[model samples]
Target: MFGPEGPSLRELAVQALSSVERGYDLLAPKFDRTPFRTPDSVLESVAKALAPLGPFADGLDLCCGTGAGAQVLTGLCRHSVTGVDFSAGMLDVARHRVRPTGGPEVAWVRGDARALPLRAAFDLVVSFGAFGHFLPRELPGLFTEVHSVLRPGGRFAFPVLAPPRPTRTGYWMLLGFDTVMRVRNALWRPPFVMYYRAFRLGTVLDELERAGFGVGLHALPEFGRRDDGSPRARLVVARRTQPAAGNVNS
Candidate 1:
């Protein structure tokens, strides 16, 4: 699903061998041409869903690549928008892409997601197309980091697609991809951590709860429903817990 301007097969091979940051830096110029960038359609759907919740003061885009999610934050937030990622290359691209908007000021920080540097600073946090880089065991730490950055009553939002059922060919496709990734990582260096199957919804919700967020799912009916009428995708909204002593905002 790569565009004509995307990386060539040789470039892909070179990137696959380097570490994540360097690989992304080399790919930064061509990333949007690939299927990896979150589409504007998803961004529009999310913006519509979050708009009514509105008028947030600050927003954070976790693992924001090319600042696609940050653009959505511009609609929901009024004060400032920040995007943090460990990849310097990705951050560079993001900074450039969102530069001329001049509507909502943007900041790009280079840091690992597990130990984010902010403390209760953001009113809204969002991420897109980057979760697969994290392993299952890393979810708790990742969620904790996100929680630590959010102010009381602030939200962490992201979209999740429904898992494929046994009857679906998509199920087997994802299964095969994950299996190959496991095998590849077992033998490769500077392991690429993107896997289609590692982040299950139940486990993710449990981790968010443990990290002190009150969670809810907002079904995104745009993608339609399954045979049983379950939503094909949903936006997970987890609001940061206020102190047990009192309601900080009130």
Candidate 2:
């Protein structure tokens, strides 16, 4: 659901018809006002979870639309933070909106997340609400790029909600959404690739392990337990494990 300042149904329709990059560019101004942006509660939960792992010297936010996760980096990393996105418009909004109020300096870089420019350059990396744009096949390179950017022992973290059960209404909702996206991509010239069902946690953990991260999950207690008593959401913290030299002295 969107607020008064958010995009109207007509505006959302127009965005859905456009390519992912172009749609994000069009939506950048109202992104924070929409449901698409990561909520502050989730970000706060993540920041608290990551605090014990700090203090990092530098960090990067992969596919950082409006830099919500990147803002978390300012508190975790003591030195600098960089927010990168393929959409110039999104980066522009991030530059002005989430500029570091904490001690760490911030920079906005316009580039693709699949082929990040940095190498072993950051102490930490985080992303939020941007995974639906990438197909499952692209995750290998996406994880690799995140691994490449982080200093060994550095973390590549993000929140992943539990997949809905087969009988659940939410399951059908995602299944229907993915099916519609596939049909749209089949008929449309430039595809709109946001699909809720594409990113699976189990499959994702496998991909991340193959990409050289020692993966672990931390339960976000604030979201509470499901009916089965399993935590409904977790922060996937994948640490790059190369050698002690890549380790954080702090």
Candidate 3:
């Protein structure tokens, strides 16, 4: 649900019909006000989870919309932090909104996630609420890019919630949303690739390992656990154990 300052119903409708880039551009000004933005609680939890891994020198926030993750990185990283996104409009807002208070120097860059623009330059990489934009097949390339940009032993971390069970209303809602998105993409051009159900945890872990990361899952105590006793949410902390041999570092 959106706040009063968030996008209107008409505005959301128009955005849904546009290309992903343009839609985000149109939504950028009010993005932080929307439910779409990563919540402060999630960000705080991630920062706490990643803190022990740091005092990292430099950090990159992949698909860093509105700079929420980048702000988290500033606290953990010591030198510099960069927030990259394909949307220049989002980058512009991030530039103005996420200033370095006492941590690393922060900067914003406009770039596609699939083809990021830096080499083995970062010690830590983080992303929040952006994976739904990528399809299953793109995971290899995406993880490869993240691997290439990270120094050996560096981490690529993000939070993942355990999917809701079939009996839960949340499960039905996500299924319905993905079903709608599939139908929309089947009919529309320049598909706005946002599907809540496509990013499976098992598949992602395999891909991360294949892309040369030594993957691990860290339980985030904030969200607690499900009835099954598995943590409700966890941080996937994939360490770049080796260089991505065949992958070009953008």
Best by lDDT: 3
> What would the per-residue lDDT of candidate 3 be over residues 180-202, giving only the tens digit for each residue?
98999899988999999999999
Q: Is candidate 2 or candidate 3 better by lDDT?
A: 3
Which ranges of candidate 2 are over 4 A from the true structure? 243-250
Please rank every candidate by TM-score, starting with the best: 3, 1, 2
Per-residue lDDT for 152-233 in model 2, tens only? 6899889988888998898998899889889988998699988998888899999888887899999999999888999988
Ranking by lDDT: 3, 2, 1
For model 1, the stretches where C-alpha displacement exceeds 4 angstroms are: 100-102, 243-250
lDDT of 3 at 49: 93
lDDT of 3 at 63: 97
On a 0 to 100 scale, what is the lDDT of residue 160 in model 3?
96
Worst 10 residues of 3 by lDDT: 241-250
The TM-scores, one per candidate, come to 0.94, 0.93, 0.97
lDDT of 1: 0.86
Candidate 3 local Cα displacement, residue 160, angstroms = 0.2
